[model samples]
Target: MTDVHRAIGTHGFERLLHHLVQLRASQINRCAYCIKMHTQEARRDGETPERLDRLIVWEQVDDFSEREKAALAWTEALTVLDGKADLGALRARLRAHFTDQEIGVLTSIVAMINLWNRIQVSRH
Candidate 1:
């Protein structure tokens, strides 16, 4: 996944956005370890305390950008697949902000974090 991160970073995926996606997915999965890890990493990378604190209610809050919202929405849709996930619409929204390759990278990031979240959550 480090390779995926590097690849995505090359495509303009900033560190803060990466942490945001990881944090959002971890939150959806209720993975305390990942949530803590990503939140700390985000802060270490200069993410504002206000944004980090408000990330749980990102949709209702006006703190995130359209791109961040799209990524977070995609992360949630992918993480909490309750058979009603609107993948097409989510992909469309992602496309509005990211290129096809970037979308692929974003999907990979979400999938990776979900995998980690499951592992971490299952351990407890």
Candidate 2:
């Protein structure tokens, strides 16, 4: 899981996107430690206060691009573990902005973060 996390940041999409993905998943999982850690990491990497503040309400804002919004939709759906989510529609949205390889990387990032969030949350 750690290795996959490293790879996700190092490849496919930008580091900012990776941070957003991880942070969003962590937010959904209610991992306070992760939320703090990822928020700081993202800010250190130049993510704006506005973006971080608006992250939870990203769908209703214009601060993010279509590509980012697509990624966020995927992240939210996966983190929420919604069995009824229309995955086909999600994939189509993702495909509009990302390649298959990118989508795979994004998926891996979400999974790794969710695992980490679970571990972190379980400790408390």
Candidate 3:
């Protein structure tokens, strides 16, 4: 998964956005280790404190761009995967701002983070 992220990073997926996605998914999964790691990485990558603080409430905030919002929404939907989630609509939202390849990478990022989150959460 780190290799996948490295490859995607080389292919133009912004590092800040990648951290944001990982952070958001980690938050949803309640993985403290991931939250801490991603938050530090995001800060090191120059993400704003305010944005990181408000990430969990991204939908209600004005600090995020349309692209960031869309990505965050997609991350949440995939992380939760409850029966009530509207995956089709979420995919459409993601398509509005990201290419198919970008979407695939974003999906992988979310999936990988969720796997890590579960592993870390279960160990404690």
**Highest TM-score among the candidates is held by which one?**
2
Better of 2 and 3 by TM-score: 2
Pick by lDDT: 1 or 2, better one: 2
Report lDDT (Cα) of residue 120, candidate 1: 91
Q: Give lDDT tens digits, candidate 3, residues 1-124.
A: 6786677666677889999999999998889999999999999989999999999899898999999999999888888888988889988988999999999988888888898899999987
lDDT of 2 by residue, 12-77 (tens): 479898899889999889999999999999999999999999999999999999999999999999
Global lDDT of each candidate = 0.88, 0.91, 0.90
Q: TM-score each candidate.
A: 0.90, 0.95, 0.93
Q: For model 1, how big is the CA root-mean-square deviation?
A: 1.8
Off by over 4 Å in 1: 1-12
Off by over 4 Å in 3: none
The root-mean-square deviation over C-alpha atoms between each candidate and the true structure, in angstroms, is 1.8, 1.0, 1.3
lDDT pick, better of 2 and 3? 2
Runs of candidate 2 exceeding 4 Å displacement? none
Candidates in descending lDDT order: 2, 3, 1
